[model samples]
Target: MAYTTDFEKLKKQLNFKPDPTRPVSKQASKNTKMLFEYLKSIYGKKHLAGQQYLQSEEVEDLVYYHLTGKLPAVRGYDFMGVSSCKKTDDQVDRAIKWATQCGGIVTMCWHWYAPNDMDDYSKGSSFYYKTTSYDHKTCFDLCKGVTEGTAEYEFIIREIDMVSAELKRMAQLDIPVLWRPLHEANGNWFWWGNHDEQHREAYKKLWYMIFDRMENYHKLTNLIWVWNGQDKCMEVSPDTFDICGDDIYSVKEYDHSSQKQRFEYMTELAHGKMITLSECGYIPDPDEMKKDNAMWLWWLPWWREFVYKREGYKPVFDKDGYTVINKKYMTEDFMKRVMAHPDVIMREDLPWYDKDKHKLPDALSANLERIKSK
Candidate 1:
């Protein structure tokens, strides 16, 4: 129904003149806004939380502490994946219970495995690549094996399916998990990378198949899908990706004038679908990226520097330790520079996850605002 009338019109307009400088028309805006509101109503209020909200002030505290060699803050970035340093599962559960004792939502991170369903290995380090010992390979292998395998996969699916049941069991919780998946698959290193015909073909096929297979298929409408990928991958202009992108990674000091080119290229190609950073890393001298013509002149996961010691391919370690990466010295000043930018921690631009049993609306809004901003 929406497509037949409102969506169709917008699609036609974009087809006619697809330019970022040109704003989406009034009718299109109204239509899209209505949809956004309705979606916000459904997911934001009923599923996500009662209202648009924010938490974890002083975003820099998280990064600054990490920079000083201290752990991330307890408010948002603490848990390695699920639990905080101080709390056990039961203790954390008790804390969530306490938050909702007054009737408020508690947030969690929703995880989705990326670059899967491929016959070969290439998208950001797959099992085929892992046998050779890439750092991401082991994690990817576990995630894919656990998520795709019948036993563990069934458990993961059942957990999501059981969310409603959990909600029914408790009156205090209403928070929605900001689920993100297949992040940064656009790079040619993942199993589902779109760089090659075979990989691209398989990626689309997997998306279709994933939709077909999930038990809680209804929950997808509730889930917010964020696609993360390297900016350079869009150069091929190969396949049509349905999800909005989040910038996955970049180095600050390199000659990266091409970064924004990559961003604009991907954004234009997306036709205003919605794009964010997903995960922000640190980049010193972001101006270099601007000068280099790069898009999204930022960083993602300082650890990814270590993580990039990926399977099979050794882009950074091509030879002796002499093989260089971004900047040999990621100085404190560089860290401070990135820590100060609003763009780094914006959740809408860089939502770390959607499922952990809670969410922070303010973080989400900050990111969404950045994307909507001119």
Candidate 2:
């Protein structure tokens, strides 16, 4: 009774047609299948727009704007809810609740801090780039059991297990998450990325291991796996991810030429899998993306601090200047226009997914009982 078989049965029962024209990863879970089908059903018809809010306060502004105009088609959440590196569960919950209210799809990214204290705490490893020695070779070996039964292996497994538990909670809530982990791995920023040629296979191997542990071991099926699209790291196996994307950033406004090239590369590399802008410093104008034929499933600009700033200008906190200049990047006026575009798809445009069909009733009841006992 393989878990994949169960997913196949569910897909068949639900009459989901996996688009033969698209490249669907073999490892796509049941939830992934449904998501892919939905995306395919509407490809080219509309592009989803999204934003990442750094604080709960920001959420209110986005919510109010969406309520009056167009809501984001997808909401992005970080796994800060249960990470040992940081605590922001309350903030995470607030984001999720808003998404649920607006019928927006949810995607998650994890800034999985270096395993153990192997990270150079004093220097930095915030999201990308390791300022200090965070040995990728040693860490990958321990994580993959190449150094089986060692302290490092035990420590990492314990940590990942905790992550698994948090995922299980999301499943119980019937949250279909687009799970993107170890993103931007081809870059040298994250400890998980920039492995030497010998350890080049390490990042890929780590991804598969996480998939196996979460699906086969923890039985977490409510996820759509996304692979980071970097030229060198695009060599992932056919079955690793349901979708692929690259983070697009430009020092000056949306560099149209640069955006077109990167978007084209990711699409071709995807082999028909849906391509998206996972993270962006400046949200490409919907009109521009369409003009370039770089149709992304969704484009989520980073938090206000990143999205609102001009290319090299120092960030201004002044209320008036902030409101005026930030429009160059992505202004409320621009967003309103984008959301109103016929080619753009916002949260309200989505077709309903059967909540019960995707739910883990057993897990949900157990969680409730635990809360009651507490």
Candidate 3:
């Protein structure tokens, strides 16, 4: 497939100004500030392509690279390993490796299993409310969890301390992380969301508590908070998060239409802050996104079965014991096209790859000026 100049013409047609806002964290590290500025610089003009990895093995990224010959600029990692009691350090290590070696941006989310309530480690870590014996009615009390000198408080604090230690490791190395916790709170799948009004208030308290403890107590300035609560009722305080986003997965396999409606809804919820397609199945077509005026800061497609078709038990082996490379939510051709689009920023296109520099590259600065001039 050949790249086209049509996107260049489209870029000229769309007038997008760079966001001059700094990160929400007042004491954010130099790299964190640079990452936020870079994201703002490309908003509405181009978007960073991303892929989430289930583990540090790089299976998902390898599959994407095999199909597109280009790696995603943003690499998504999960802190579920700590919650699950498996590979606790590997996820953090892999994120650091991506930032240091691969020259890619790092985004992380936590699948926080209920603290002190691992009813069945048999099936591994269960972050879902229904998977465990977590009863929001009796067994769980968000108010008690936030209060000091209580059993509930101890449980949550212990977990947060563990995760904080991991985050501090990155901060020590000057790595900026797009930290997204308590994701999909509006959907109610996770223990943090889909609860009563009191619990909802407690959820916000929990967010604030985490922010206070991490930012003030732990002194972790490398984190750029990305809020993913999809509903207005579940939205965190505007000052608490640096960016807000929504997770949308299309049921239609080849649906490449830009999710402009959700984008606009999130934009309203963002309160002047930048918005993103935090998690997605089918990457919206770049041209469609430009036409709809809903260019997200970035989009991260889920792992394994979402990215590639799996016929057998494992993602690698098919029913006939053959290697599977067929596309699933996105077609192979569309994946190539999305990666090859001029408006999509890949790993090789990132301006802050140089570890020594703390400023925007001249090319990106020039592009920002060009967009502003239009």
User: Which of the numbered candidates is closest to the native, going by highest lDDT?
Assistant: 3
lDDT of 1 by residue, 145-233 (tens): 33354443443344334443332232224332223334455654554455565555555444433322221233222223334444444
Tell me the spans in candidate 2 whose CA falls farther than 4 Å from its real position.
Answer: 1-33, 59-68, 115-129, 132-146, 254-258, 308-325, 353-374
* TM-score of candidate 3 relative to the true fold: 0.82
Show model 1 residue runs off by greater than 4 Å: 1-63, 66-172, 176-178, 194-199, 211-216, 220-222, 229-243, 246-258, 279-299, 302-330, 341-374
TM-score-better candidate, 1 vs 3? 3
Best by TM-score: 3
- Report the lDDT tens digits of candidate 3 across residue range 101-171: 66789999998765434343344334666534554312345567776777767767877888999899989
lDDT of 2 by residue, 97-150 (tens): 644544568888877654334443333224433344544322323234323446
Whole-model lDDT per candidate: 0.34, 0.60, 0.74
Q: Give candidates' CA RMSD values in order.
A: 13.8, 9.0, 13.0
TM-score of each candidate?
Answer: 0.42, 0.74, 0.82
Deviation in angstroms for 147 in model 2? 3.5
